[model samples]
Structures are given as C-alpha cells and as structure tokens.
Target: MTTEHIDDSAWISDKDSPVVARLSQLISALTNLTMETTEDLQVANYGVGGHYSPHFDFYHVTIQFIRRSCQIFCFRSGNRIATWLTYLSDVELGGATVFPMVDGYIVPKKGSAAFWYNLYASGEGMIFLRFIALN
Candidate 1:
C-alpha cells in the first residue's frame, strides 16, 4: 500500500481543485473543527487487479515509526481531524476499504466519500483505519 503525509499549511495549495475544495469544506463543517491546512494527502491508486491487504495503520519499525504512525501523531498533536475517503470511481466487484474491528466498511462511491477517525480521545489509535482491501 502507498501513503502520503499532509502538512497543516499545504492543504489549500495542494487541494485547489473544485471537488477537493468542497470536500475540505465539508470536512471542516462535519468536524466543527479547523485544520492546520497543510497538504500531505495520500493518493493511492490500485488498478483493476490490485489491492491493499489488511494491515494496521501504525507500527513502530526497527528504524522508527511508520507512515500511518505519523498520521496518529499528527492527530494527537491537536489536529482534531478525521479521515474522509472520497472515491473517484466505483468498481463492480472489489476494492472496498474495511475496518473489521469497528464493524464498519466503506464502499467507494464515485464523487462521494467515507470518513472515520484515526485516533480517539479514549486513546484508541489506528484501530479504525486499518487498511483492508478486497480482492
């Protein structure tokens, strides 16, 4: 799987498209919170036969923390943000991102989206955004 890091200052410059602009607005409205407005957006593309296997978002590797771990850190650092997955297209058969632990699942809807928290005040982190892609 591929991931990208968003900064608090680059969200506007990077998400200048009309659709993304609307999405950013929606995210702000839904959370009743403000973002640092950076751009470290991750754009992972899986083709017809490609898929991301199940995995936890954060983990401490031998070298350091992983990418998703940074996502957790950013949230804990006071972002008060949530993740919204806006699907660009719909597939007939596969590629749904699922969170088994939360008993929640997101089916991609073209031009629409899905959302969930990467961290919680109760101290749960990365359990809900576990990337489980279907084959």
Candidate 2:
C-alpha cells in the first residue's frame, strides 16, 4: 500500500465514489463554499484493542510539496483550511477524535461528522460537529 504522512487501514481514491459527489454537493450548498478536488477516501480500520494516540489531522508541510503524490491535482502548494472527519462505524467504547491544544474531543457515531479548521488563533480550532458548532 502507498504510505506517507498517514498510517491507517487503506485508502480508495474518491474519484469514483458516488457518495463523494453527494457529500460535496451537500457541503457546498450548506456552507456556500466551492470545493476544488476530491482527495483519497481513507478507510481507517481499528483492530481489536486498537488505538491511535492524540494526533493532529493535517500534518506539518515540508518545504517541498510540488513532487508529493498526495499534494493535489493541479500541482500547487497546499494549506489545510478545513477538515472533515466522518465516522462510518459506531464506536460504543473508546474511539474519539481529540485535539490537545483546543481542549476538544469527539466520540464519533455512524453517519455523524465533525468539521474543523486545521488551525486557529491559539494554534488549534473551533470545530463544527454537524448539528452543534463548537467555539
């Protein structure tokens, strides 16, 4: 499998998923923002007693991003302005997305999503977890 800044189960290119179009349309309509391209759909599988420590969603950018495979379609330097974390499965126990700097964390459920800007004034974020926007 192709590896780089992230370590998870596997990723499928979002190019062919019908859900991608639907999601993009919904997000655009709701937020009044235009999305440019679809990134790979990462499928994160949690093994028995599996865990990922506190982590940041968007990683630190190196000086050179022009040659990175995960960069973009148009070949431009990328900055993470926003992030969408969608939970495909229900987690009854201990899986939660947490931000150490912002004092924020989320226990995700199936069909539920959390959207947050990757950075903020205090170097974190104000997340919008679907229904409720956290500030």
Candidate 3:
C-alpha cells in the first residue's frame, strides 16, 4: 500500500471565528476532553483519487518521552489520547475512513463525525488503532 502525507491547507483556531469556536465546543463535549487538551482545528481538501495512508494519531515512545518532559516545564498537554474527526462535506464517490485491524469503515457525510481512542487509559499508544482515508 502506498503512503502519502499532505499538509492541511488551512488551520483554524477557536479564537479565529465563532463557527470554529462552536465546533471546538462540540468536539470537546463529545470527546469529554477539555479545550486545553485539544489541538487546533485543521481543514484538508482532497481531490479525485486523493488518499491518506494508514497511520496512528499518538506519538511514539521516544517522541512521547520528549513531549512529556517538555510538558513538565511548558505545562502543555501530553500525547493525543483520542481523535474526533468531523466530516464537513459528503462524498458522492469514494471517501471513507478505514481501520483495518478492527474492520471499521466510515463513509463521509456532511455534519457527521467519527471518534476513537488513540491511546489506552494508561496513556499508552494503541498500536492496532491505526486508520486510513480513501478519497
């Protein structure tokens, strides 16, 4: 399976607009996570045949160590514990989120969202919980 990493064209914060603020609030409430623990909102646009290869949302052990050490002094949140993906548009053709390990597949629909845990309750990354997107 080929892999591709495309940076999001836009990144919006809650403070940038009321719409994003409301979306952030909804994400927080749904995930049961505080705003401080969440990252800024990202918007990615995919054209025909676009795709995202399988990947994990949480950091690796070494990166987690560095991040945790930094967080001790910087007072920032640790590695990602969960992901809440909100679909802003519907796809007429192929656009689906897939989790191969667990045989999970989610079709894109406007105003719909998918949520999943990336880490265990003990803060360890769930290795089999990787996902991919086909567009």
Candidate 4:
C-alpha cells in the first residue's frame, strides 16, 4: 500500500460545522442510507508521486473475525457499504482513479464526486470494485 497523508483534523463533526452537516445530509439523501451508518469524513492529501494501491473498502470475513475483539466501534456499526469520494482540487497530471476490472478511469477534477457500492445487498464485498491511484 502506498503511503497517503490524511488530515486527521478534517474529521469535522456535524455539530461543529454547518457545512459538514449539510454534506452529510446530502450524502445520506443520495445513498438512501441514514447518516448514523456512515463514517466521518476523511480528507487525504497527496503530493506528487503519492498513490493508493487497489483495495476493497469492505471488511472481509477474516478481517472481521480478527478485529472483532479489538474494534468495538466497527462491529457495532457494520462493514462499509458504500463510498462517496469528492475531489477537492484539480490535478494537473497523473492523478486518476482507476478500476481495472471495469476499465474505469476517473480523472481528478475539482468539485467532482464519485460514488460506488462497496458491498452487495447480501453484504458480500464487491471484489471487482477496487480502485488504485495513478499518480
């Protein structure tokens, strides 16, 4: 996995910021899922040559079993069901989200968002829905 820098302070609570609250509401509305089931917003900053390797968002059976005793918060909520990614800034070059299985490529554009289901209705991870950062 490639290293990425995340602004930990960016996990703004809805009560702390009206913008965050509105965004959360919008996401809940778009996904038809309650905000209670969603995780806090994450902001990752990538510099030149930064990238993320392909991976699934949902937890696998083995992972769930291993983390069950240690992660109470995760178990209480559930595995990730969906992903809603919003690009904050435009990249001049080599910053694309690629899904190899579907031949999908999304260029990073400011204010653009991408949404996808990480699991099926039956709660199985969608193995084909993996993304890698090409930068």
Q: lDDT scores for all predictions?
A: 0.59, 0.56, 0.78, 0.77
Compare the candidates by lDDT and give the number of the best one: 3
lDDT of 2: 0.56
Comparison by lDDT, 2 against 4, better one:
4
Model 3 sits at a Cα RMSD from the real structure of 4.1
* Model 4 lDDT-worst window of ten: 1-10
**Which 10-residue window of candidate 3 scores lowest in summed lDDT?**
1-10
Candidate 3's TM-score: 0.81
TM-score-better candidate, 2 vs 4: 4
Over 4 Å off, model 4:
1-10, 62-73
The digit string of per-residue lDDT tens for model 2 on 12-121 reads 54467878767877766766656665455556766445555443444344422444564553255344556676778777767667665556678878989877666565
lDDT of 2 at 108: 72
What is the clash tally of candidate 3? 0
* lDDT per residue as tens, model 1, 37-114: 534455666666666666654432432345785767656654423566667788788767877877877888788877
Residue clash pairs of candidate 2 = none
Q: What lDDT, from 0 to 1, does candidate 3 have?
A: 0.78
Please give the lDDT score at residue 84 for candidate 4: 88
* Decoy 4 TM-score against native: 0.82
Q: Name the candidate that leads on TM-score.
A: 4
Between candidates 3 and 4, name the one with more favorable TM-score: 4
| lDDT (tens digit, per residue) of candidate 3 on 39-109 | 67878877677777777787775643555555563356567778888898999998898899998899999
